[model samples]
Target chain A: MTTTDPSSTTPPPDRRPGGRTARTRAKVLDAVIAQLGEHGFDGLTTDTVAARAGVHRTTVYRRWGDVGGLLADVLDAAGDDDWIPPDTGSLEGDLCGLNEEIQTALTAQPPVMMALIASSFRSEPAADAQQRLWEDRYTRCGIIIDRAVKRGELPPGTNARQLLVTATAPVYHQLVLLRTPVDPELPSRAARTAALAASAGAFTEG
Target chain B: MTTTDPSSTTPPPDRRPGGRTARTRAKVLDAVIAQLGEHGFDGLTTDTVAARAGVHRTTVYRRWGDVGGLLADVLDAAGDDDWIPPDTGSLEGDLCGLNEEIQTALTAQPPVMMALIASSFRSEPAADAQQRLWEDRYTRCGIIIDRAVKRGELPPGTNARQLLVTATAPVYHQLVLLRTPVDPELPSRAARTAALAASAGAFTEG
Candidate 1:
């Protein structure tokens, strides 16, 4: 028996069948992403989303309650379907992989990201969703730092959240604030700089 | 002759006496800020701003042209009125001062900052203002890093923009993205971390 590569063998999460309920969820969420990209948070309405999704308006209202609920579900679905943290035997490798994943996501769907960011600032539900997403990502990325610490690659008591945030903040700043191009070298540079800082205990709480 | 402290002697920019033209400009800009804070960019309209400012609608239309123009003026006024980068004799002190200034501005008027950020994403004029604002700050803070290099404190050719961005990005991430409380110690920690990274050539372009 031979082990198969998960990437090669596994069906895309949305493509895998779970019957009618899953199909409806996939359709609704896809419509939500499309609408968000087209109209941003301000212009998005449940009626529009329901119409676009070809689902009943009452079903959208009853299920999601409001724009915020719908947004939260969209965010949850966005995070749920992809990109588990990789364990690549070294902190640098893991962090680089994580940064690459981020770069890919941001590049692949910039408009959706822009909408999500705008929503986070203006809408309470969206803000909550954004917070939960960051917190969840931070918790998952903690394993990379923990592995590094165990291998004596980083100092003990390293602040994983700080490290991960520091590594990724520049990328977000570039994408969202500065509107600068995120060059190919950026992810590795960010990861390397963060790894260096962590090794020197810059992220350790005093 | 004894020298008086500049801060004590200098009238605040907004309070300084000027003619009717200056006063009118100030009034309009103040209204822009208020409208931005209250309504954000999407909701802000030049007519509403003119109404709020108690100026003639035609005057606003002639002066600012549109909502984006008003927002650009607001951002310019916001950046122009306050927070000159400090020359605190050392890189760490200067960086800390810079971060504290940012924290102060963000805390002092969160709604205005949020409005500016939102506008930057949606409007071209606002995005230009945002870009100019960051470029100006980065250039001003470059003096800090240059001084450090001259004093043999940091390595030569260190990228000032990178250092300042890295030091500040986490704070912005907390405020804008994470919606987390920026603790009192965060400024100093960010400064220290950037300083450490700068020393290690993390910010030096290859």
Candidate 2:
């Protein structure tokens, strides 16, 4: 019998980079986020990233191995202060608050965040990084819906992750893909839709 | 004091050295789209695009002008198929059909398409091209929705453009930014949502 598996890993390409100074690495990581915001993934390059971070060229290569690795690390670091969905004990209030929080954050350099999400298509490191990035946000969202489910505010079989992704994804596309300015009122409306979707069993596993 | 527009024409960055060659342009465009599908926009280059197209290094630049221009042309040509929503006389059926058509066209090469969209941020030409690409699709969509409005299938106040964009944008993101696999069924769900949203006066103008 022939074995069939499309899943395969490719070896990482070595950049032969001289390696960055420790201080430069930290700065570069921050700069990666900012650059992602500024230039977007397509526009970002090692030269630009290095310049922005004030790091030596080789250091970015030796440390990150490539652009994908660098972005993955940045995503890992961006993990902070992004999660933490509120729980007002009511699913509606919790989601509304979370959407508001996201909307405010989106207002600042939205292109960068969008680019990061968009960048996940490149390969190994990017795919892994995006997965990690979404995992954190999804987990936080899951907790809120789980609470709702437990309290019977939502259906007993709600798939919180689906509800969360479906709800927020529209907001992301409206701003990022379409390049349309977000309506100020839409975030709360999204949350309301999310809450209703939850109550209406749109997320119910059954 | 001085009254003037920014410029009669945008920069000619899209122009390459020498002059444009139709054959070279078409080949280079193919290469760009092919590479974009495989390697994504973040890390690809004119050299690679040239190599893939079997053109001289100078030809890539001389013909397409630059990577951005190459990408813009490729995307424009891809969407030149001129898809229009069928006049099935039912808004729900029309949207669902269009949704499925887009899903079929997109999910197979979603990564490459997304990479192009993300890269558009860095190049004004690419951005302009993207807008043009969407306009064609949207125009056809408008025709369908507008007909529905005339038939009373949709509310008179419907924001057809927003309704159309919302219905379609998520499908793009599912395969691109969210990295979710797009199932054939999913498109119909999205279309149904849009149809229902429209019927509920979600598209109505205030």
Candidate 3:
């Protein structure tokens, strides 16, 4: 599988997976998300992560510099930009494409996602990165809507920006904010809902 | 001033607010929200909150039983059940009404709101309570859209639940997930947009 390129230009810990540094980073990052899911922003600490990961305290501190850096790395790793925009010649078909992407993501691992959200309040870098992630996601989203706007399937002056956001925001609330998992069917439903919403006049063009 | 009525057979702690016990409870609750805003779930501690609030650490431990319990109390304290149904006599009024309520609550204390979001991931009681909070908000939302469904402004077989959620999900995303604050006017604009979307046919009853 092709791996997501880390947005952080930080050199990979000069070691292969299963090697000492790789194993250590993996252990610590995993532990951080786990502890964050269990604890919260104010509850997370390097000590707890190290203990959970079974790594030496020095090793944890040395690699990431501090908890903030560690969290930044975790969020970076978590933001898998593997989504492929759907081109189904219709808004409904395109949304199904996007939902499938999110479903794949939610199924793979929620640890980093849980941590990024948990710590977003306290960490400025995390906040910035988190916003950037959305900007990227929405930028991708507009591509699908742009087609409808072009085809006159949607209103002439539809606010593609709001349409893009309105389309994806539900899956987010459903998966991360709400406790219940999004139904396997929810993605397709969401896509159609978004497409229909867009067609119904969800935006205002400048 | 007239106090909120407690005659509804609910627990005592919720009904009243004032003595040293009330003050202590409020401070501890405030501290947890503030600390969580500054800290994340895994970083929280009873010690820190007690120190921050100038209450005895033992008092905090005694009242809440633990950090989890403290989070519950904090969540409870944040609630205001003055749910007002929108009555502009149109679907547009209802949508704007729902949007305005959420914007007010979120901007009331941004840090606290962020802290609550982060904390819910770690604490089950916090998450459940938060879910109820969303339900409270959603229920009010449903009231608005149901009016529209009755008015025939929407298509027959409209799913008010899905429609209402799709309407405001972007507002939440703008503030919470995207970290971009919504403009004050955007709420009203969004409401209109959503109302139109509903009219033009965005959702179907499941």
Candidate 4:
């Protein structure tokens, strides 16, 4: 019997149709998310993650190095998911959609979000990753404000990031900081409040 | 040499005038705050705290039992501090004052605040303490909104909690979530936005 070479078992990075390298990355990342959801940041360990992913500990060590590296990959993969901000014509509708997205994330996977936020406070690498995550989210969500401005729903020069942050902050405060249940009406209320503020030009930077 | 009883060396709990009990408690609490500020929640431990406080390990063990109990006391003491919310005549002034207070806390002791927030996620007792802290802050801050309504600055029946949460969420998002440098203008801007929303009746529960 001819022995198969280990090198032949792995595909090049560009290979598209379910290559071994791609499969390994996917499995590792999926395990990261699952671990974050189940145990939070403090409970995450490379060995545990490797065991969960059914990968060798040395592979995890060589690939991710540590928890920070693993966390960055997890956040990067999450950021790469296909998500388009809503274009509902009206500023209120756009903001409501945005709020709904935040609410859904916080409600459905609180542990993962909490772990990410907590990581921002603990390590430099995690902070960099979290900052990048927020920057990416802000850039994507800014489209709502841009569309609203083009539609004459908001005045020109409105700070899109500020508006979105204002609209979303209370939802996070309720769910994370206050540890309170986010009522169904809270997101709509936040969106309406933000819309009112935006129309009044409260977000305009001088 | 006359022998003294070890039990008699300790003063009763209620005895004041800088008694040993009070001094020990003060040192322990101060050490807790210092540990939280320096090492964050993850690095804190009873043995370390007791050593830092120069108190007996048994004393810490018997008194606090765990980190959660120590955290509860720390929060309780912080809440008990003499701080009256600003009652500026207008909603803008009151909110601005409120914002400044939060900004000061976040800026002056970011690690302490971060540790407290992180602790809330890790333990049920800490979560309870955090919830109570927010509730107390909200009630105290509500007086500002109440006065605003009395002065006809906002619509009657406006949700005080909603307005305060809206006004402060951005500050927290800046300092904690986004990890952005909180510009001096951010708090006032947030106040204006919340004020605009309150005037538009966005905070009214319908």
Candidates ranked by DockQ, best first? 4, 1, 3, 2
How should the candidates be ordered by lDDT, best one leading?
Answer: 4, 1, 3, 2
lDDT of 4 by residue, B135-183 (tens): 8988888889888989998999998998999999888888877878868
Clashes of each: 0, 10, 19, 0
Q: What would the TM-scores of all predictions be?
A: 0.87, 0.72, 0.73, 0.90
Question: Which tens-of-lDDT digit does each residue in B95-169 have in candidate 2?
Answer: 778877767766565456556776775667787788777777787678887788899888776776767765675
Tens digits of per-residue lDDT, candidate 3, B1-206, equal 23555575644443255745777877888888778767656567999999999999999887787778888777666556475667889888777777887777666644667667767766788888787777666776676767777888888777666676766776777777786765787677667766666676656644
lDDT (10s digit) by residue, model 1, range B2-79: 344556956445434574556878899888888778777766888888899899989899888998898787777666
Candidate 1's residue-wise lDDT over A1-206, tens digit each? 23445668555444345645577777788888899887777678899988999999898898888888889899887777565798999998998889888777776654887778777766788889888888899888899999999999999999999899888887787777787786787788778888888899998877
How many times do residue backbones clash in model 1?
0
Candidate 1's docking class is medium
Q: Note the B-chain TM-score for every model.
A: 0.84, 0.77, 0.71, 0.87
What lDDT does each candidate get? 0.81, 0.70, 0.72, 0.83
Docking class of 4: medium
Quality class of the docking in candidate 2, CAPRI style: incorrect
lDDT of 3 at B142: 71
Q: Candidate 4's residue-wise lDDT over A75-154, tens digit each? A: 87778877888877788988888888888888885467777776666667778887888789889998889888888878
Question: lDDT (0-100) at residue A58 of candidate 4?
Answer: 93
Off by over 4 Å in 3: A1-63, A74-83, A107-110, A155-157, B1-59, B77-80, B155-157
Q: iRMS for all predictions?
A: 1.2, 2.8, 2.2, 1.3
lDDT of 2 at B139: 74
* Model 3, docking class: acceptable
Could you tell which candidate, 1 or 4, scores higher by lDDT? 4
